[model samples]
Target: MAKKDYYKILNLSRDASQTDVKKSYRRFARKYHPDVNPGDDIAVQRFKEVKEAYEVLSNPHLRDQYDTYGRTDLDSGDVSHGTTYGGADSVEVNNDVFETDVDSDIYEVSTGEDPYSQPGGGPEPGSDLSFELTINFENAVYGAEREINVPTFRICEACSGSGSAPGTKTAECKTCQGTGQVFERDRYSGEMSLVQCKACYGRGKIIQTPCMRCNGNGSFQTYEKILIKIPPGVDNGSRLRIHGKGTPGVRGGPPGDLYIVIKIKDHEIFERHGNEILCEAFITFPQAVFGTEIEVPTLDGTAKMKIPPETQPGTIFRLRGKGIVDMHTGARGDQHVKISIVVPKNLSERQRGLLYKYARTTGEL
Candidate 1:
């Protein structure tokens, strides 16, 4: 049998610093932790090897003895040149090993003091909530107030969020003896580690009687009506944030935020391009040939615009300060009107005669 190299196991050199050793250990531990790779035999073996390597390299005295004699075992009394090293003593792991909660991205480490063992437990912030809302195109351009119903979880009022009936008290968890943690020995590695207590879920205390209304859950689902103000010039895919409007927190922690994703409806008469407005207006052939005044739709109301003589079809005219207002700069944009010529389908006998005489004069008859 041969001894494994501690430095090689951690992917470090013998001259690596203590900080570097600890950093590599945390990275490997997170990758091979039992909770992260459940039921994987290969990962479990790698985790045990990483732990053993860290235990020897983290201690200064053990590292010096290994460097000199190439072995850390002192119980055999095989000393070179009558040198004496420290006898076998239990090694205390100062650096913490972490267990991750994938859903919440929370890390539970072996820190001596358990947060849930405190008087009122710990304050955990609520999770943020998001919702999508659709608004009218006019409302998005000019802005308006909208009321929406959001269904979410709220703290129960029956037992005041305690999860217990009135006058009933909570008792200490016997499984962990109120310490919120328990020591367990690994069957394969024969190493002991502290893990969160499953009985009380690391809460040190357990409710004696469950709440009748909430069924022992601290919160209940309900619909909340909230009035939100939409800012002007908001386009589709705009997001609005409301503070402290999400789910209720635990143990007096702050509530999360509420997010509203905006979706704008299509308009029949007008189209928006950034802060600018675009619209098409139909004009008679005579009106386009000779100058005339026409009415066009705008954000405020209808506005009159003048067309010049000899104007061609598809000519564009601009009306200043008739478009949407800029939300941030407070500046207004221009409205563009595209001209389209309309030809009469039916012509009277007298009108046809006059048109034939005009065509003869122009040498087109």
Candidate 2:
């Protein structure tokens, strides 16, 4: 393999600060990490490249030596005497690998960079699923509750949430000595660091005899019915929240919420805009010319509406407090019905003759 340029690999300038180099290293590491890529060969190699770049650029003295004298100083060229203690021999090592009094505390622990990757960080909440449920236009105007049969896991009856069998106890966390932390002591920097215990994972205990029902996973797979509440006057995309209705959380955590989105089915005779309702009713030409009583649809039973004499086409009749009710407030909205005159599609011979005679008598076109 060709020797790679660490600076170019990290996309840092020659005069870039140490922090800049570290940030670049972290960015590339997150992208090319083996954990993120799983079985990707190219990503694995790129991960190695990012690690190597950080290994060189993270150290101040090594970066300076590489910048000034190039790669020659990294191998051999010059030697320096450093302090020794406790009968240790005077060892000649590159300043980059040797730590002074002020190195960061993160290097004292394991090589893993991510913080949330401890063993205790397991899957918790169940996923939130969504599906469309349509309600009747009237039912939507009025709130309702329906018992929906949805697929979701509930608490396991066999082992509860503990995973261990009944009458059994869990073992103490051996990795952190029940404190749930790994104490790291660095002789080179003389600083103590604490990290989450990778073994017992801050739980301070472990199950001895695993539950046969849940396989010590502390959760079971099953389906249960849940009731969904639909509020009145809930338009499309109106979301109703149901607490503790989502998937069960892991390790005795509370379950998440399930949101029921409200959608009103289209009414056959009415169209709604906001809280108001609009409908178009067809009337005969005679009905518009002469006053007549007509039955109109409303939330209540059909009611008779009076049409004034000489009523023209495209005239709207307002029915106060007859429209859909406001969901937030109990106030009802008025319904507007526009009347349009209908003309006969096919004219009879007598009708044509009468219309022609009337046009001649009135001198109208």
Each prediction's whole-model lDDT (CA): 0.69, 0.62
User: When superposed on Cα atoms, how far off is each prediction in RMSD?
Assistant: 22.4, 25.8
For model 2, residues 285-345, the per-residue Cα lDDT tens digits are 7788887888988767676789998999999999999886664445888888888888866
TM-score of 2: 0.50
Candidate 2 Cα outliers beyond 4 Å, as residue runs: 1-129, 157-218, 345-349, 361-365
Cα displacement (Å) at residue 193, model 1: 22
Clashing pairs in 1: none
Name the 10 consecutive residues with the lowest summed lDDT in model 2. 103-112
lDDT of 1 by residue, 67-86 (tens): 43346775343434444442
Give me the runs in candidate 1 sitting further than 4 Å from their true place: 1-121, 157-212, 356-365
Candidate 1 residue-wise lDDT at 288: 84
Best by lDDT: 1
